[model samples]
Target chain A: MDHGEKRLMDKNQESLFVRLIPFFERYGILLLILIMIAVLHLLQPDVFLSWRNVTNIFKQVSWQSMLALGVFMVIVTAGIDLSVGSIIMLSLMGLAIASKAGMPWYVVMLVAPAIGFLCGMFNGIGITLLRMPHPFIMTLGTLYIFRGIGNLISGGVPITGFAEQIRVIGNGKIKLDVFFGEGAREYIPTSLILMIVIFFIFWVFLNHTRIGKWIYAIGGNPGAARAAGINVDRILIVVYTLCGFLAGIGGLILAGRTNSAYPNAGLQSELDAIAAVIIGGASFFGGRGTVLGVFAGVMIMGILRNGLNLMNVSVFWQQVLIGSIIILAVYIDVLRRQLATRT
Target chain B: MSDNLVLEAKSVSKFFGTITALQNVDLHLNKGEVLGVVGDNGAGKSTLMKVLSGLYKPSEGSLFFDKEKVTLNSPRDSQNLGLEMVYQDLALAGNLPIGDNIFLGREPTRKVGPFNFLDHKKRKQLTEEHLAKLKINVKSADQKVEELSGGQRQAVAIARATAFNAKIVLMDEPTAALAVKEVGKVLDLILNLKKLGVSVIVISHRMDDIFTVCDRVMALFQGTNFAESELKNTSRDEVIGWIMGKKD
Candidate 1:
């Protein structure tokens, strides 16, 4: 190529790079996650690449994934549900008490989710009808209230002796015997399957449903949403309620996995779930995120913890690393938004 | 002409905790007429519009639409009665696509079994059709509102108001932030709405737009009707005098 032609091509490439900057900012987390996986595999190939360990990671993160999904919706509406962890603990406590009362296992399952829905409704009502200035304060208040109730009910002890059927919901695995030879079985945790199914349902809802669009619209600009004839208060209530309901489901899975419902179960879980959602790509300021992005986010956290554990990294160091990643994720989001506005 | 009046407000007053935003204001809008509302910053132009659009209920007095007495409790109530407002802020969700913003609350949906899903194809087609009919020069319906220029965002907001079959459209400072050329486009849009026989109540500080588009001008001075006259009968100086509380 001639010198002028080469310079012209270089200018075109430069412009193209500028154009792709926003795209990179958006999916950079996914890339970082892939790089982390590669690095972990390089560090401990035998342990990290094992299917058994991979499935274990998925099982470990499934309940947290559920909580993240719920938090994702709430964040998308420009709200936060700080009460999620407490709601989960409270729901599990209700399940434990019900099971101890000799209620049928199926009935307890139904009751647990019902308790969760009501708790969510309480948050919703407190914010919507009471006209709370911000959901942060509302949910934060409920967080303490619900946790206090949980502690009171459980008397600061664990509730055990759950039925085997109930236990299977968390610990059971679906084995693919047909696809593998003897002793080469692949097992998928039931909870993981449930999480995936819930994710799929929410993906369709957020993308294809009117309420989902309203959630984005409200989050993007609530004054506009109201002026456009949307019932902003109603949608906000629905979102917070759903967040609580999902937290209830997470509580049930936790109870099943441990075969007990401890008063302090799911403590500080809200932070992890919020971190996962933010790390996935949802903006803390709201009106931006995708369900797929959230799944990727949950996976990133799962992989990070698992990789660190495999490396025998100290728990303190893991906390520091995860905290740094959260700050990095939010900083990237801020930069992405700035680029978006500029373009 | 009086029989053709589409909306009439009689002695409407709104007070915010002893602060009278609007006091005993009387207004009238005729069919297919562009009525300009001119006022100073605190002259209660926006307050009056809010009452007409049902954002706030009047502290006292009643509204009449199509010669019948009525009450509007909310924006939805006004919208149901074929009245719509293009707020000064434009009220467009920046993150949403043009089509979605245009049909944010009133999206078309298709039912599958017991579930309802957005009919995105229909929405896009209708958005395109509306933009074309209104001659709004935007790239596509799928383009996000944030990506559009100021004039284009205003066009989308206007298109949204018109697409819902509003008989009376109230606009607040529609040309306040537009470039000179873009301001011309918005003025032309108001003319087109008039051609379609839609009544328009435009609140603006730009006297040129009022002269170019409004049929009759209403001036408010400190929340009261300072002057009301036909555009041809009133001059810019006279309107300015009314706004400045120098003449009534």
Candidate 2:
């Protein structure tokens, strides 16, 4: 088709809603949270809009956002990592065990994520070298294997009593003074600051780098990418390793926040992170996703949980609700893809 | 066809689990010759080119470049030897810009160390200069290769190979999917490459293309060479008949 004809046809093929749907999908969760808060403000402004609820929401999502960023990388390559939760558990166990044995705080923090990196490398080697059918299957196997190992190490009980200095990364915040006013204080977490910095760095890595382009290209059409001479296996390995390392860091924060590390800690956390990524519009088929979209996704999940808590929703029903939301979001994604291909 | 030969494949054979894809296929392309291989589907024209381009290694026989026998283990091996292939699919990442796709694996880097970054401006200028030298009408280096027409994308692929200093190019039906005008553009490109002294082994079933541009024509049938002759001496009907496996 000529340029003019093609442009006309594209416009005719699209409606305002159809064009907006992709944009909405990227930020739909954030928009939903805003709308929900608006509704809550109309109903019970005092309790729902309180500073305590706001801080609680940020605290809850601080670690999950980090997990989402890792998942974002994997999903862009059209791979699934079910082993993040297990990797987190394994990292936490390593950190707690090492710290209990008199390892230095810096040494524990740095060495903990390396354990996760090794797990990712293990998954990468298995998946790429063996040519598994899907990363989902490969990582699912590792998920159970790593969790079992975590169980064997911890003996099926939560590891507790970390060094006081190590816990400060999770529990302590830089105390803000004089900025608000005399005697006014606003605490900002080291973990949350770290998340923002990591997010910014990862955003640049995915968008502004050649390696990031390779990841998307591989996800889009691996055969074509290989023909173009990209080392798909190497890139996949790096992606999984980064995912493992992030999960490790998140697990450290989780351990510090709760003052304990359980074998079942971060159980099903992979599902939450994956859901957030997909909800943010990263596809299972690969080749398209963004950190910004995922940041919005974590925000949506955080707001949903926080809003429910403020509204006195029970924990059991909250799980059901979140599960239903995840299913609905994925179904919508599948439908959108179907509609896209049909056109 | 020349006193100094650039590439020759001697008695190359390939098998796919008892299915002979190519058998004892001997072919030669001297420097600056547009050697055309014409055959019907399943006649091993593509298989021969793939073997030459190192997409597949011959199970039997030897390949020589510049009178030196060599083993090409992979496409990278072929690339290092200044040999490149432009497959029917073009081997481009459509989602990426033309510049990025052209320099897909070997992107220019600047700033070094931890703060290293892609030298986008330098890459763009180099790509534009290269494309311009080829007389390939590209709208912009930043445009996605997919946004270009079939013929323009082909030109981009050819331009990229030339930029990489390829001495031998293997193009498989470069004009098969293009429009009539686009076909003319690709024909012009082949002639242009011939002028630049790049030896090309072009595989196509199109009689007109072979007769128009090829200095020599090689006909294949059922995984083997049926006839090989200079275009000045070979008749179109004779080559077509030989391509159909007619002995007499």
User: Against the unseen true structure, what C-alpha lDDT does each candidate score?
Assistant: 0.90, 0.83
Q: Each prediction's Cα RMSD?
A: 3.4, 4.8
Superpose all Cα atoms of candidate 1 onto the true structure and report the RMSD in Å to 1 decimal: 3.4
Off by over 4 Å in 2: A1-44, A47-51, A314-343, B1-4, B10-24, B55-62, B67-69, B135-140, B145-156, B177-185, B232-235
Indicate the worst ten consecutive residues by lDDT in candidate 1 chain B.
B131-140
User: What is the TM-score of chain A, computed separately for every candidate?
Assistant: 0.91, 0.88
Q: Docking quality tier of candidate 1?
A: high
Model 2, B40-153: lDDT tens digits are 799998888888888888999999988789998888898999998887878776667888878876778777577667788989999998887777887678887767888998
Which structure among the candidates has the greatest DockQ? 1
* Prediction 2 TM-score vs. true: 0.85
DockQ of candidate 1 is 0.80
Cα lDDT tens digits for candidate 1, A1-343? 8999999999999989977876776677778878988999999989997888998888888888878998999999889999999999999999999999999989988766787889999999999999899999999999999989988988989989798878777888888776786566688788888888999999988999999999999989999998876889899888888888889888888878998998778899999999999889887888989998899899999999999999899999999999999998788678766866774
Per-residue C-alpha lDDT of model 2 across residues A165-188, encoded as one tens digit per residue:
677767766766757665555667
Candidate whose lDDT is highest: 1
